[model samples]
Target: MPLLDPALWSGKASIGTWTPPTGGTAPVVEPATGDVLDVIGVATAEDVQVAAGRAARAQPAWARLPYTERAAVLRRAGDLFTEHAEEIRQWLIREAGSIPGKASFETVTAAQECYEAAALVSRPLGEVLPSAEPRLSLARRVPAGVVGVIAPFNVPLVLGIRSVAPALALGNAVLLKPDLRTAVSGGVAVMRVFEEAGLPEDVLHLLPGGAATGAALVSAPQVRVISFTGSTAAGRKVGAAAAEHLKRAHLELGGNSALIVLPDADLERAASTAAWGSFFHQGQVCMTTGRHLVHASIADEYVERLAHKAAQLPVGNPDKEEVALGPVIDAGQRDKIHALVTASVDGGARLAAGGTYRDLFYRPTVLTGVTDASPAYAEEVFGPVAPVRTFTDLDEAVALASATPYGLSLGILTADVMRGLELAERIPTGLVHINDQTVNDEAVAPFGGVAGSGTGARFGGAANIEAFTETRWITARSAQAPYPF
Candidate 1:
């Protein structure tokens, strides 16, 4: 699919006569060649208001539909996603700089989520509670009106679509604000699915643009809920804006996840899993294992194995079938990674391997001898940099992992099942994986974080449905009984 073809898509600003943003459209460059893939329209605040209003108007009828009808729509959308997978995958590679394999995985995963959501919505809301008097006390999940979805550029399709699916499945209309960088690809994919599913035209509106558009969406009174996934700073702003209007907000923000390697663990497996988790999507994932806490006895062996694996990762064009690692999202992110690494080195952390930045592509970096004083140990380095630290025992490892204010996800690798179970209970993070890397995310599990990581949970089947809906209880006393209060 050609990027930025005025004929292909109606821009967020207006229907026809759609022009690219006049602020000299920034190039969405392919990370490998620095080639301009497309120019996305930077939407203004007015554009977002229009979209939000449209969605709010369309929500009532959608919410009134039967659960089975909503399920059918979702199923059809999933089928359409499968049919157009190839086209969407290509766009993902070009715009988001995701390797062919990873891009394909993301597209397929999103499609699967649609199908799963359909099944979830089709089930009964809740069973009637048994009561002494003849009364109907049943909990029913009802849509929370129009939900504003602000998606991040990294893992655009999967993370972006996740917010929409559960909300839409529960009969909530959505105003999807995709990141300008990957809007063409992500927006097109969503539009195609909804169109093919025969959903109401205004049920889901795509508002593609930058920060200004997002602010407008959050501020609009029509938006009942705000679902956001991005940087901690941006998330805070969105949350505050939503709070101003007393609107419901769900946020999946930044994380500096840790992977703990116990003394009795298999070094090779832990090393391999950690490498994949830390470098996947150039380590831009909120759940990616950016921190490593290894037992002192096995720290050297684990670090050496991890370095060897990192060195072998195939870094090249995202469109290439064999490429394993792709570029950071843009040059700005590249500079940020460089600055963090330099500071870490200056703070006395030893560079274990791969710490250099080249234009948009940063090498898969690993740092050791990191102290709490260093930013590398404390901050969320959303890059392909893994900071390793040593721990004398399990308590120490757990303590170090919990030191950071953010508690999103953490992984523990060990052979002792008892120890793993015990550690899992003590970890402060929301999700903990034993004998695996932190990247192990199941579609059905409750995926989210605690503390600064953000609020609310996604996935976990029925739990997700409840998150997008509000409950109301009804009582009838036959109109004959006097006031019992």
Candidate 2:
């Protein structure tokens, strides 16, 4: 079955179906071949207001619904992801510029998140505290009423659903604003899954739109919490707007994450890890290894291995061929990635492997002899480009990794795992993996960035609680206590 029915935008709907979006239309294009996949509704600022209104009305009832029933619905949602994994995978590949494996990963992530969110309903929601007076005192978590979720195009299914499912499960309504470019996989598909799983009417609204729509959602008086995942620049605006409105904004922003290779690390294994970290999903990831810090002893061999791996990996239309990487999202994104690489080369960073493109298919690139000033090395080059920079010693490695303002994910490869752990602590990062590469996540792990990255611990496990709910203190007594008159 098509995960998102085009009829959803028909300006009309039968009972128990999606409310027609209040926006214009845009064509969904496959980046690989420039094929118009489908025409989808584009939400406006007014559309966001409408969605927020509906969500506000629906939220109280959803919050009051029996927790078991809510959990059941979420479990069913999880099942749907698994049952329709193939169709979802196809949409992800075609619509989101994901390769088959990456598509599968997103589908699995969606399912896993649902299962984890369902479990949230069964967790203890309140705690008893000491009563100073003749009364019982308790602190309880209550849903933040209507949640506003603005998700990005890259890894849309997971990034959107991670917050969406948990907020709903925690007893809140959601107005989701996904980037119009990847609306089908990011917004409509996830909404469709919830609908099939029997989510209550008006509890979730999916609106695909541009920045103005997001601004509306952020400023809406009814939305109590905003979950935004995108660039650092946009995240700052979201955070500022949310603060002005006195609501919570959970932002997971950009990163130029690093992978450190120690001298003792096996060159072959470390290079393989580095290649996957940088090139996976065309390196359009928040935790993409933008800087490669390798000990000078093995730097030359590591560069050769990394470049060879990048060259050998097949890059093409994922749906048509078994390719390791797919096309970049569009010409603009492709050009931007290429510009960074070219600028780095111009600034004296040697191009070790790729610095070319065919249509939107930018080759996986590697750079050697890069300095901190290299644009591609310093910036979050969200493409299939890996820039290798050499560090002379442990102190130098620490300096190189700490050079950026971002503290998202950090990876260190070393034969001495304990030493790697010590090094990880010295460098500030929200997530770190010793003997591994930077890009990694699981549904159960707390995932967020810090410093220039974003608000820390905004999703997964206990972080979800903080993101989706508010703590309210309650006091009760068998008889009403009188205050002094």
Candidate 3:
């Protein structure tokens, strides 16, 4: 597939060409091959302010349209995704280091998000409240004007559209700041989709830049709600800035999620799930199983099987048909993961299989004897590495899993499905999977995390629409009643 032209985004940002106040242009590097894919102009604070102002002006007219009319445009955009899936897949592989399978999944899921968000037009926003007197009282949901979406590099396209589609569906204009690494496909490509789908210009603005641009968006008075997905450290700044400015901020942050295996669980299936969960997309996913807590009775055999599975999976160029794991985002990320793995092994975490990298391609690594204090066991490695531990008691396993500051997602594998469900409830994370891995998501499900993972503001279903809207209470009287005012 040929690389997309950078001219695709030229003059497409808020109202006109988005000239950066400084910092010129940045190269988008292909991590797998270290290729200079293209260059994108960086947006500045001045550009962010201009985009937010345009979005604010465009939003009220959009909100006044019947939801069905708005849904039509979004539904067309959804259809366009399926029609252009292959091209999007190619871009994802080149720009984001997504294997073919992962790229396909993201593109299809993103399309599904657009389709589902269209249905949100019919979803009830507010309920009628019963009154003691003969007055009628009810609440109506209204758009929060302009929504600011700051998405991360990993899974940039889907995560960007996840907020953008729903915000537009709920009658709000959007100011989107996609990750600098994925500006071309994730940000500019999406803008084209909406534009060709007949969405009015200025309703959706794409500003691609770094932290300064994001900070400007968060602090913009015209931007009423801010929805962000990225690292916890970045999210903290975005959240605090939005709060200081009194903007509604909804964040989907980092995670160090876990997958637990009970003694009676299917070892073969559990091993397969573990390998896939820990290494898919080079484990860049927020819900990737960073830690594995297995029953002591079966830990040895399970780890052995998992190691075998990890070793056999192909790890190479994301463009290949058979490669299961791809490169991390960049050399810095690869070095970070490598350093963490090296430190963990030095700290007594047994390297059961694969602890090496060739350029950006890191092997699928599995470790045992990882103690609670090990960095591999504690932090979000965000790489294709799995660190397993043994636990005799379920309560102990739950406590150990919840020890991290993140509460994003959890997975439990057990023969007893009912017991897994019970344990799922006891888990502190916002999402839990029974007899499955931690890295699972659907377009229609309520997706988010709790605690350090996120703000508990889910991104799908009716909650998606609610996140971009505000509720207003209104009352009507059949007849004027004497009041002491």
Candidate 4:
């Protein structure tokens, strides 16, 4: 099937276009070559209200349908995703600055999520309750009415569809506010997929814009839940606003994850994992291993091998087939990554490998001698920069891993799998990987973080459906009895 037109994404509902405020249009640029791909109109606060109202009106009929019907639609959507994976991959590369591998991975993951979400439709919503008396009590899960989804720019297709597929499968109407930059490909493509797959026209709405649009979507009273994935700082505002409105808010936020290499780890395996974890997608992933904590016995050799591997990956336009690490999403992000590297080096951290950039394309960088006092150790660079540190003992290693406020994900590389599992339990992250890289996600896995990283709402399988629904307790009397008020 042919993809939808980009021009169709202008502050629209399923059927008609909403009038945008006098907000000026913004140009969507290809990060690698600094080329303007398209100019998109901004969605105003009014647009959010209109979309949310439409979703609220449409949700009841959708929720009333038998789950099998919903499952059928979702299955077809998944098939559509498989059919157009290559086309979708191209969009991710051009608009999201994703390298070929990363783009392909996202497209496949999205297709998987659609199929995985189909199973959620038939999963038991509530269990039979034990009755205490003649009265029968029961509980069942129902749609939250309208779920407002605000997705980030990085990994937009996977992250955006992650929420939308589940919300729709559970019969909640979705109002998706994709990042302004990826409005056409991420937002419109999703809308078209479901519409073409026989979904109800008003059940899913897409409105694309920047911060004002997102805020409006969050604050709308008609929206029963807000599923947001982005920076921790922005997530706080969304969570707080949802709380104030007494709405259910599910947030999958930032991660300053750590990758730990024990003394017994295979040097070659650890080095390759570290390079892939830190430099993939230029390290913009929430689960990217931001810090590398290695044992003192293997720190020097591991860092050297990691640095050597980082130097070999090609950094260029994602449009090219050979490029492994492309540019950061924009110049501002590039500057921020460069600033963190500069500050870390000036503060006495040793630069072991690449530490420079040409335009938005930053070379994969490796640093050693970084201490807790260094900004690179404390903040999330969200770039292709890895800061390595050595620890003398397991307790110290655990401490270093748990030092960050963000507890999204962690990785441990060790030949001793039992020891790694024991350490994984001690870490305060939501997800842990043994003998693998930190960046891992599947449609069936429960994916989210705790503490500063997120609101403890996982975004796959049953967890996703739960996030977009509410529970109602119903009671009935088998026989009429004298009741006092």
Better of 1 and 4 by TM-score: 4
lDDT, candidate 3, 397-485, per-residue tens: 87888788999999999999999998878789988999889988877888889999989956888778679889998889988888998
Per-residue error for 332 in candidate 3, Å, reads: 1.0
Please provide, for model 4 over 283-397, each residue's C-alpha lDDT reduced to its tens digit, 9 standing for 90 to 100. Answer: 9999888999999998889988999998898898879757988889888898999899999999999988999999988999999999998787789889998999999999999
Task: Evaluate residue 37 in candidate 4 and report its C-alpha lDDT on the 0 to 100 scale.
Answer: 78
TM-score of 1: 0.93
* Highest TM-score model number: 2
Error of 1 at 213 (Å): 1.3
* lDDT of model number 4: 0.86
User: Which whole-number lDDT from 0 to 100 does residue 460 have in model 4?
Assistant: 78
Can you give the TM-score per candidate against the true fold? 0.93, 0.97, 0.96, 0.97
TM-score ranking from best candidate downward: 2, 4, 3, 1
Superior candidate under lDDT, 1 versus 4:
4
Off by over 4 Å in 3: 1-5, 10-23, 479-485
Poorly placed runs, candidate 2 (over 4 Å) = 9-20
- Evaluated at residue 100, the lDDT of candidate 4 is 89
Clashing pairs in 3: none
Q: Which stretches of candidate 4 lie above 4 Å from their native place?
A: 10-24
